[model samples]
Target: MKIMTCPFNGPRPVSEFFYWGEIRPMPDPATCSDESWADYIFNRNGAPGVKQEWWCHIASNTWFIAERNTEKDLVLRTYLFEEEL
Candidate 1:
């Protein structure tokens, strides 16, 4: 079975977690055009590569960020949002 390490709860079953999506920077609303905001909301990177994503531990109601590789399906690290970006 797959396992994911939760920052608060330690390692747990992967099934206990929920994957949100990749972390992307939002375009500056003040300076960005309509097309830029549209692209930011609609487009997603589907390519296989390392990316930081949002994850939640359902049982504990804990939300965190996970750095994972899509190609290899490996989690490099996990941390809370308040932690270093």
Candidate 2:
């Protein structure tokens, strides 16, 4: 079974966690056009590569960021939203 190390909860089975989605920057809603806002909400870069994504630990209700390599299906590291590793 795959193991994911939660930033706060340590190592645990991957099954205990949920993948949210890739972290992307949101355009400033005040200055951005409608088309830009729509595109930001609906589109994602689906290319296979290293990406930082949001993940949640179900039991503990912990939220964190996971940097993973999609091509190899590997998680490089996990950290809280305010941290990097």
Q: List the global CA lDDT of all models.
A: 0.96, 0.95
Q: Considering summed lDDT, which 10 consecutive residues are worst modelled in model 1?
A: 76-85
Candidate 2 deviant stretches above 4 angstroms: none
**lDDT digits (tens) for residues 1-85 of candidate 2:** 9999999999999999999999999999999999999999999989999999999999999999999999998999999987754
Return the top candidate by TM-score: 2
Overall local distance difference test of candidate 1: 0.96
Kindly report which residue pairs in candidate 2 clash with one another. none
Per-residue C-alpha lDDT of model 1 across residues 2-74, encoded as one tens digit per residue = 9999999999999999999999999998999999999999999999999999999999999999999999999
lDDT of 2: 0.95
